[model samples]
Target: MENKNIEVKDENGNDDLYEHFRFLADKGQQPLRVDKYLMNRVENATRNKIQKAAKDGNIHINDVAVKSSYKVKPHDVITVLFEHPPYELLLTPENLPIDIVYEDDDVLVVNKEPGMVVHPGHGNYSGTLINALAYHFENLPNPAIINGVNNTNRPGLVHRIDKDTSGLLVVAKTDIAMTHLAKQFFNKTTEREYVALVWGAMEETEGTIEGHIGRHPKNRLQNTVYLNEDDLHKGKPAVTHYKILEKLGYVTLVSCRLETGRTHQIRVHMKHIGHTLFNDARYGGDAILKGTTFTKYKQFVDNCFKILPRQALHARTLGFIHPTTNEFMKFESPIPKDIQQCIEKWQKYSTHAEQ
Candidate 1:
């Protein structure tokens, strides 16, 4: 077998990381159905997900796309491809402050700040969470070759959120932890929750949004929902459940729980139902989408936007089974001052409007 180690993505596929896998069967491997075989092995994958991958022509054997029912034989070379590209970064450790909500021998939970990028990428080569990890810790287990370069100081990240998003992230501190924690995320057994400030007052107190999300054809930076059955090729399945926390007239504060973490699941799904995230520039929530057309109202919103320049979203909660102890644990982070202050302004404004 060439490689058996797997990397996973958030069930809601986070952007900046397209997830893929390669599995080489052992010389003495027994015949088994592809989906079943894959379900037992791959990371961030489920039997249904594998079947979907097969249907999307993303599952291959010897470079040939195959059905989920295809039986695996000894020495079969299996490849699973998503829009995911290799995200290995050569670490340049930086001295940065990180909020550690909880830390154990197996894992560490970080309350990441909004402006901090999770890892290094094209334009951002420094001041990343990965860079900070390298500086603070001796090493995190990652034996895979990184972008055809040196693999030293590589941090193991089973899943990541967007750069502008702030949240609780669980980091693997050892090879054993990485494997066990990855399985939790892959099986969709972990619990995650987010708080968001979205435009427009929601008519429903709580609801679920389901759609296939893929990269936008025209706008490379954006993702759109593929609602039609034929458009499934464009994206993977994503599901989010949301409930209104407060109705702030023009915008509503909502709590979102992800079922399938695809890239930009909350942002795209909220916008699809006509409620874009407040100040989410890329998704068109930067401007006043549902407010009175007046100088006072516009100025008030502009001030709120200045307070929270990025998307009004925060990952408030994360829960998973402990890799070593096998006990379930959950962590929560308080909303940052920016989002909190902005929400306060909205609350005051909406109250006056109601009166």
Candidate 2:
């Protein structure tokens, strides 16, 4: 049987479906940087965007992660993974309701819901944030257009969060706003904080995880943090600052601040340190990683999964300089109801364990 939705395992591992683009270089193809080669084949793709994808280990040649600078050879099979679907010229605007946290002429902050794909892709052609935005703003301009081509679907998207990870995200309304905001993200000046429930207690109250994050060598479906310095180019520099907010017997609630935004940075880095987010099935957190073997305990976890079907992660806060006014701006999102209920259940379980 074919899996209709492209399921991408989260770093900690809840199965979030994603779209992927695959290509094969013709035998007569000339050697060129992978990024440059991709721009021609990928609709509406810019060199910068392609390079960023390569740096994040989303670009592959014959199943091995490659850098943007890597030259593509004739008959070399290539693939690029996206959290969202590849750009198709036809982007139908759908009238989906969006939770607008704040909006102005220049920018808007949206509180994205869990299981909502940020943009439209292969299997998911409608009901995305982009589709909603296109309907809301009838004339929004595409941010990363190149060579007189524009991505009609992804207009105003400066950055993106995962499909299953609910959180706050900022969108640009104009070309100037998009350029300025994209620069902020590229320079690592933007601030993002996430709150997550992981399946273990931390030895330290607060610490930083620094590693190179890229695609898993074997598993093209997921990202992994490279530990060796020699393989740094294969991945990008990623830093996450975490503080334990609460200890719930077998699971811990953590506040994570991202210094550098790489794909799946927080989830993968947390798992790298042995603290996969609770119910993150991809990274082995879905099972009882640190809990008791008792049937009751197993039943309790199963119940939690029912309440929150995906990984326990959320984008709680976002801070950046206003593109128009250059003033500092920040926004926050409350924990979604499902995660709150899951945490409450853990709290009650911890209380009972103490007795």
Candidate 3:
């Protein structure tokens, strides 16, 4: 058999949960499905996650990316990659303040403040939520433990919100809890709601934005929605249901419920529909998207932007079934001061415009 060499990368800078695994197939090895081979070698790994990695082109043989059904041959060098890295080198605990919303033996819910990264990556190696968790707790659970390859468990992040988005996040403390919570997220049974102050009034009070989302080709920092038949396959299916909560003339406050939790789903979907989240610089919402170009109007909008320098999006509500108890649990977080001030400013401006 000819050896195939393929290079795979997650160029979106989503390296927070990245895990790398490698194995050398024995000379006596028989042809076997790559998924099963990995399951046996990678301890504590879930079959679902293994197949998902394969589907994402993260499974490679002899440096060649392969599918889940690829047959493993003798003397082949197999490698698998994943988003969830083991807790070790990056577990530098920091004595930062963490707002604990709820915690029990099995899980811990945190209302992560905006501007705090969920985990360390790139240049941010400390002052992250994981760092805070490490300081508060001993060893958390990492669901994917590949025996000798990354056999460490730390705080398990079932789902993560953006660094600039303030919201509730649940961390699993046990293997069973991590598995259960991850399944819920994968099955799309978990409820996630965000409140966003977007540019312009929405034409529809309630609607669903259905599109495929993937990393933008030109702008690596942003994700774009694919609605056309030809381009749809380039991205993954993502659905977002939204409703206008308040129409503030220039900018409308809306609530978005995600059916599929794609990266930057809300930001991309809202921008696709011509209502980008207010002050979201990456998606071109930082400048004045709505309102008159008068100097005073520009200053007012600029002041609002200054008030909420980051994206005007907040993860307000989260609901899911408890991994251990099987009881439905819900969490709500208040809009932080910056967002609140921005909204109030918009409320007053809209009222004045109406008058």
Better of 2 and 3 by TM-score: 2
State how far residue 266 of model 1 sits from its true place (Å).
0.7
lDDT of 2 by residue, 30-51 (tens): 6788887777555456789999
Give the runs in model 2 whose Cα sits over 4 Å from its true position. Answer: 1-87, 145-152
Model 1 lDDT, full chain set: 0.81
TM-score of each: 0.74, 0.76, 0.76
Query: Which lDDT value does model 3 have at 228?
Result: 84
lDDT string for model 3 (151-186, tens) is 232367777888999999988888788788878888
Q: Please report, in order, the local distance difference test score of every candidate based on alpha carbons.
A: 0.81, 0.81, 0.81
On TM-score, the stronger of 1 and 2 is 2
Q: Which pairs of residues collide in model 3?
A: 17-83, 140-154
Cα lDDT of candidate 3 equals: 0.81
Worst 10 residues of 2 by lDDT: 1-10
Candidate 3 is scored at a TM of 0.76
lDDT of 1 at 21: 58
Q: What is the C-alpha RMSD of each candidate to the true structure, in Å?
A: 10.9, 10.8, 10.6
